[model samples]
Target: MNDQNLLERYIHEVGAHLPRRSRPDVQLELRSLLLDELAARGLEADNPADAAGVAELLKEYGHPEELAARYHTEQFLISPLAFPAFRLSYGIAAAVVTVVFLVGLGLRLNQGGLDLTELAGFLGSYIETMLLNFGVVAFVFYLLEGLGWIKPAKTGAGWDPHKLPAVKDPDRINRTELLVGIFFTIAALLVFNFVPHWIGIVSWHDDGIGVVPILSDQFLTYVPWLSALWVSEVALKALVYRAGRWTRRLRLAEFALSLASIYVLYTIVQNAVIAKLAIVDGIAKFALWILLGIALLESGWQLYRLLSGKANHPLGVPSIRENQ
Candidate 1:
């Protein structure tokens, strides 16, 4: 494509990644700046070197997602600069909690599901544990950011343009999303393995709202397998976040997980009385079936993507490649 097309495409890609609220204004500013720069260099569609010029200009601009991140003011319990590390720490804490509770529950409970009183006790424990762990992490980060002890990386004269990451595919993995996924995966593993009663019915009480556990005896039997699958998911997501892109092996691993999910869901839906309440049990089963379908679809897609000539490869740093 010509230089104008390349410029528009680049703007489109960056705009696609930006938050909707800021997208239009950012895209407009980005387009005007790029066009002006191109004009100053006399690099237009008529110029033979236009494509290379546009690419060079965009490379200097930075990674699309990084650029989009700049336009965003969105943050969580902490600044985005500190969030990636905090998320990993959160996942580790979740895993620790899961392992400890699972061991304790295994020692305390028999082969059957928890009774109403036992479920209530576990619910209380869950509330207390959540408050402690989540509160500590949130408070510490909040204080750290508020104190300006944590800050974004500084860009200066020493910064190397060649250090810019390779131009990612449109489906580039979002590290924040992956990190959050890892955190939630571990949380799922913990909740199901320890406080299975967490997923229950909500009702009004004299004091306040209360939950009646929907978990059944048959569901307890699958706890070990579900825990293993969720842990695997967390590990895979963590690896992907660290790698910053998917590799052939990672895609294969994801495919395997997708297949495993399909099998587990399929098995569970087969006469599995997963919940105690009839309505809840039917909804749970239906949800499993829906999940099973999704897994199957994902498995098929992964297989096709794997067999296709265009498989995911490791991301290369742009400057590193240019230097090499």
Candidate 2:
């Protein structure tokens, strides 16, 4: 093929990926740039009939998708500004679905001996549910953004450099920890509220399979409060992520949630009775006690910070009172 034909094919491929409204102009601009680059390289565009020359020039230009992607300015359902939050939300949703599927699978296995066919079916359903949840979360965020209900801050738009948060302590707000907390909290809420039966054990014997409930019926009574606490914790962690720094208000919120969590754990530990499994009961009680102790320590630490005015300013932001 002639150099002209090859160049035309390249341009056509790029144009194919571009939006109709901008394709023509983009193609023209691309062609002009290519010609300029070839001329700068001491290559004659008209004689690009030389396969080697055409190859070299085209290589410099990049692939069609790469070139087209650079020219596309349109944002999809989620804008770049809101993408981080959307991603976190999607991850949480996926985690919830996975937890529910796994727990439900265990319950099913206990109730009716493990069957490969049933396991495969559950896997298929789990994937479908995750996809549906992702789509719903994306759509909701799109709607919220469109309605101006959640306006993500844009670059150089009323941003003050001096007000940037401080990060004196590298471990002050661990993003990974917060994200993990968000995922597990959401998963726990889903498992307890929607698929409570999954919180049990499955045993297989010579005769048949047996299922035993780990949580007592009274445990259901505390789920509402537990769910609410989990929801609040998720919301607070999300806010911390968005803010990228901790302030007095956020610290107080964290402390309150931590205290509430300890109380919830205490109640659950006291009332969660296990049937037919003393080991399971012991394990559950021990885990709850450990969690309660951790919560108390966290609450105490946050209270100390707030009282000492350490939480008054963000990492980079200096306290106004200190300046005065």
TM-scores for all predictions: 0.48, 0.42
Q: Summarize candidate 1's per-residue lDDT along 1-324 as a digit string, tens digits.
A: 332356665676566565545555677678778889989988883355566776678778876556766876776566545665566777687657755665455434323347889978986896688668877887888898889987545443333333433344523589988888888888888888888887888899899998888899898898888888898898898888887777788888988988887788767777578888877776666556555545665688789877752354211111223323
Task: State, as a TM-score between 0 and 1, how close model 1 is to the true structure.
Answer: 0.48
9: Cα error in model 1, Å: 5.4
Quick one: best lDDT, which candidate?
A: 1
Off by over 4 Å in 1: 1-171, 313-324
lDDT of 2 by residue, 87-158 (tens): 889989876776666556544533433568876887789889988998899999999989888753322233
All models: lDDT? 0.68, 0.67
RMSD of 2: 22.3
Residue 33 CA error for candidate 1 (Å)?
28
